[model samples]
Every structure is written in C-alpha cells, then in structure tokens.
Target: MASNDNDNSLIAGALFLVAGGIVGAGVALLFAPQSGTKTRKDICRFARKARRSAEDAVEVVEDFKDNLSDIVEEVGERATEILETGKDMAYGAKKKLLKALEESGEQLEKQRAKLSKLVG
Candidate 1:
C-alpha cells in the first residue's frame, strides 16, 4: 500500500512538471517579439526537448520501480531463510530437552528401587 502511494505521487509529480513546462512555453511564445518563422522554429525545438524530457522521466521512474521490486523480493527471501533456521534450532533444542528428561526419570526410578530393596 505504501509503495502504491509512492508510485502515485511520482506519477502526479511528473504530470505536474510537464504541465508547468507547457504553460510556461505557451506564455513565453505569446510574449516574445520574434518573427513568425523564428517563433515556429522555437516552438518545434521546445516541443522536441519537452518530449525527450518526458521520456527520460518515464525511464527513470521505471528503473526505480524495478529496483524497489527487486529489493522487496530479496528481503522476503532472507526473512524466509531466517525463519527456517530458527525452526530447525528450536526443534533440536526440544529433542535435547526431551532426551534429558527421559534420562532423569530413569535415574529417579533406579534410586527409588535401590532404596526400597535396602529398606526391605
């Protein structure tokens, strides 16, 4: 969800920048005192540059999205590995505890039997 929000914000920001560039270009063309031919050429150049900038921005956003996805995947894999290791360690400890308990019970039984035999 947070990633979704970040993606939305990035797209919105890009759109705003493009919109602002277009408005500024329009205002500049209106106020400039150049001949029609020169103005037309300038407009064409501005359009091309704007297109390139927009394309570059898109590529940057795509790269960032891909990087974020890869990092998330790696983190998930690491967490799973850690969880499995923890489970294996716990199982080993439990087995050791049960074995010790069994041995203690057997010792108690032997001591009780010896004491009864001596008393009788």
Candidate 2:
C-alpha cells in the first residue's frame, strides 16, 4: 500500500512538471515578437509535439495495464493450484485415518473372540 501511494505521488509529480513546462512554453511562444506566419507555424509545431507526447504516454499506460493483467492471472492460477494440492492432501489423510480405524476394529474383535472361548 505504501508503494502504491509512492507510485501515485511520483506520477502526479511528473504530470505536474510536464504541465508546467507546456504552459511556460506556450506563454513564451505567444509573447514572442514574430511575424504572423512564423507564429502560426510555431504553434502548429508545438501542437504536433504535444500530441506525440500524449500518444507515447498512452502507449506506456496500455503496456503497463497488459503486464499487470498477466501478473494477476498468474497469481490466480498459482492460488488455485495450491488450493487443489491442499484438498488432495486432506483426502489422503482421511483415507489413511479410516484404514487405521478399520484395522483397529478387527484386532479388537479378534481379542474379544479369544477371551470368550477361554471363558467357555
């Protein structure tokens, strides 16, 4: 949980820095004394750069999501295997206990028969 909070804080800090840089660059470009055509070209270039940056961030996010999904699936499969193994062990133990009880009962019956014959 602490790691998650730290990750969130790091992401927020990075986003804040990127946003500040973008805002500063826009303000600088707007105030620069340049011809109308050059200003328009500069604005278009900046917009293209920003779009590329956004696309890259999206791709990174998508990849992270895919990796996280795979990790979750693997954990779920491991948990299921562990659960099945536990059930099998329990069943084996129960069978062994029942067999022991049956053997003990047979021994007891034999001793009872011998004792009765001796008394008669």
Candidate 3:
C-alpha cells in the first residue's frame, strides 16, 4: 500500500513536470515575437515533444497495471492457501472433540451401571 502511494506520487510528479515544461515553452514562444511561420514551427515541434512524453507516460502506466495484476494474483493464491490450512485445522479439531465426547459418554454409562449395582 505504501508502495502504491509512492508510485502515485511519482506519476503525479511526472505529470507536473510535463505540464510545467509545456507551459514554459508556450510562454517563451509567446514572448519571443518571432515571425508567424517560425512560431508555428516551434509550436509544432513542441507538440511532437509533448506527444512523445505522453506516450512514455502511457507505457509506464501500462507496465504498472501489469505489475499490479501479478501482485493481485499472488495475493489471491496466498489467501486460498491460508483458507485451506484453516479448514484442515478445524476438521482435525472437530474429530478430536467428537472422540473425546464419545469416550466421556462411555465412562458415564459405566459409572451409572456401577451405582445401580450398589443401590440394588
């Protein structure tokens, strides 16, 4: 869980960096006062750079998703193992309890027969 938070923070940081870079470039282009054609070219080049950055971010997200899936699978398998272990322990305990009860009943019957013989 802590790692997820750290990952989210990293992703947010990357997004902020990308946004700041785009904003900085726009401000620079607007303040430079170049010819219209040159300004358009600069904007196009910056757009390409932004696209690549976005693609890289997307790839990172995809990889994160894959890793998360694997983690979930591992957790699920572990939970199943824990559950089966608990069930096996419960079954053993139940068998022991039943056997104890049966023995206790036999001892009680023997005691009652002895008391009847003494009273008679």
- Per TM-score, the best of the predicted structures is 1
lDDT of 2 by residue, 24-95 (tens): 888888899998789878978987887677667656755775687689799999999999999999999999
After superposing candidate 2 on the true structure, give the runs of residues whose Cα lies further than 4 Å from its correct spot.
Answer: 1-24, 32-42, 111-120
What value does the lDDT take at residue 37 in candidate 1? 88
Candidate 1 per-residue C-alpha lDDT over 11-87 given as tens digits, one digit per residue, 9 for 90 to 100? 77997898799779967986799888888888888888888888888889889999989999999999999999999
Q: Candidate 2 clashing pairs? A: none
Q: Please give the lDDT score for candidate 3.
A: 0.88
Kindly report which residue stretches of model 3 are placed more than 4 angstroms away from their true locations once superposed. Answer: 1-32
Q: Which residue window of length 10 is worst by lDDT in model 2?
A: 6-15
- Model 3 poorest 10 in a row by lDDT: 3-12
TM-score of 1: 0.80
TM-score of each predicted structure versus truth: 0.80, 0.63, 0.65
Considering lDDT, which of the candidate structures 2 and 3 is the better prediction for this target? 3
Write down the RMSD of candidate 3 (Cα, Å): 5.8
